[model samples]
Target: MKILVVFVVMVLFCDCVMTKECTNTPTQLSSHTYRYALLNSKNKTLKQEVLTLSSHDHDHLTPTDDSAWASLLPRKVLKQEDEFSWMMMYRQMKNNNGGSGKVRDSGSFLNEVFLGDVRLDSDSIHGQAQQTNLEYLMLLDGDNLVWSFRKTAGLPTPGVAYGGWESPNQELRGHFVGHYLSATAMMWASTGNDTLKKKMTAVVSALGECQEKMGTGYLSAFPSEFFDRFEAVQPVWAPYYTIHKIMAGLVDQYVFAGNDQALKMVTQMADYFYKRVQNVITKYTIERHWRSLNEETGGMNDVMYRLYTITGNANHLLLAHLFDKPCFLGLLAIKADELSGFHANTHIPIVVGAQRRYEVTGDPLYKEIGTFFMETVNSSHS
Candidate 1:
């Protein structure tokens, strides 16, 4: 999860600014009230009552409320205006003459902004950090990383599996491989290092083989029954969260390193979940059933939203919406300041996904929810 957070922080770095009115607002809940509300929020009966989405209307994705929030925070920060890539391409906006200039495709904002274009100064702290990160990325043993994956596929596991989280007994055994793929992909893109590219390519190839061996769209170091545990609402350590990391890593590989096989693997993974989610929603309300498990889904919504942008598949778009947690987001949809006692790390990624949703769908509700959450977090929680 730390590595996943590192990847998220690297990609979604933004400046948070709050207005005086927002900051001065008395929105903070008392400790007692927070605890009471938190417990009540977890009430299964009450959740089913309010959180269930009975309507299968496609309009659910498009919120009816177009009312603007009172907050004045901006929605996005252009890359050209930022320090990291000041010279990078940006979407053309209106000029001083009130005329819109030639605009770039919103979906391809970073298409031409290759990381290799920027050279880090070796003496700087960022450069040193990059050097350390690059060395660590290269030092990871590919066999050790994929050992559990091979074992799960009935392939001969030649190398000793790493202890701790990567242990074969661990539910999150294959998650690090995803993180490694993302890091190496980004590193190769940034440095134009042939060695890193080759290493990442080999890993992607091995993962592709594993995916084929499993004979399902699923590809993980653990058995598929983990998801069965997830669907059963039994004790399980965040199967979807691990899958999100894997999907996000494959996405990074395809986007950064231009690996077509990575794209195919991730699309298959999405299709697998799309069908799985379809099966689950048929029995019960998506909101109540999925949220009732109280599992950490990581950025499943965000990754799916990303996949939709790439493939433009309607199923991919709908699947992204399926991962949205209405129990929490429904509160934000109504401008409720009820984030107290909610798991911070777990839900923050939901907001990140909301931002991506707004980008892909042009849904005003998503923008409002994302903007309000950011404003609320900056004003009070931070």
Candidate 2:
């Protein structure tokens, strides 16, 4: 009896070890470092440039303020990527607005504080963020942000926004606003601020209600039937793209907001995909109609990897690979450089998944190919 008991204990120990190996928790380097690196690399913010990105008039813009916009990013990534994106935006804004150093400075300040490089002047900071309308994406100003959340909450308001973005402004308000949710939430949690955190929490709650109302554990700014249509291959708007926005937003909420509900929300959506996608053949056929319309299924992998991140489910990861669709997989598997004419944003997130695949599976080739794709896209497309 003693021998048998000892053997059982040994087996349990081995199983525990193997389970740990399979879990997708960051075992070594932080999962967040690369993102901050990208932000810094975005605009060329020097690592040593720690100047306070503030003006005398900016800090008091809002009364009784509290938020973390200062420390959400991973330490290695905080300085560089945050600045780089600002540099990129500054260049673009310069081209459009003409000689607005202050505009670029505001972007720089926001990124710096967001990643924890400096404290923002609460009073002037809001004005600065609002003044640079294109970049800051202040969620507080318009009825649109609240309405967007309410619409997704199923409040039956005609003016209710959907997709958590002002649906009327896809390019300006949709995916980009999601990035703000993520960044803002991250900033708040890392720094212990309740305002931004509360704001994001409300949005998350509204979206949760929407998911509940749909009664299928799925939520989005778009209609629920979008997935069915995608499976049916019927004509529809970019369902996968919209899914990416929500997926990324949810994942961001988990990462930035530290909300257990956010994690559950993401997992439920993944479970929904796992439950629904396999036998649905018609979606592909419906998708083919886009050859005439020029609107192809873009941003599929973004959602898949987001699912993979939350559930660490092999099915979610495999589904992302499945999204290689008829167009890219065969060629991408072979490392084709001929992928030039594709929409830049649509495909880059796919490569991001390939990179994640490499991370979890220890597949070096996925890393190589994903890096190559990123290099080509950043250099040529942007």
Instruction: Return the TM-score for each candidate structure.
Output: 0.71, 0.55
- In model 1, where is the ten-residue run with the lowest total lDDT? 89-98
Of the candidates shown, which would achieve the greatest lDDT relative to the real structure? Answer: 1
lDDT per prediction? 0.67, 0.47
* Local accuracy of candidate 1 as per-residue lDDT tens digits, 1-382: 6544542342234221211111222211212222223224434553243223211111122111221221111234223334222111111110111121111146743455678678789899998999999898888888788899999888888778998677887676788888898899889877887887888898899889999998788999899898876775554556887899999999999998899999999999999988888887777656435443245688888999888778877788777776776555655755668766665655778889977776666555677889999899899988
Give the total clashing residue pairs for model 2.
37
Clashing pairs in 1: none
TM-score winner among the candidates? 1
Runs in model 2 deviating more than 4 A are 1-143, 146-165, 168-177, 189-192, 281-303, 306-310, 375-382
Cα deviation of 295 in candidate 2 (Å)? 5.8
CA error at residue 190 for candidate 2, angstroms: 6.0
Global fold similarity of model 2 (TM-score) = 0.55
Q: State the lDDT at 296 in candidate 1.
A: 61
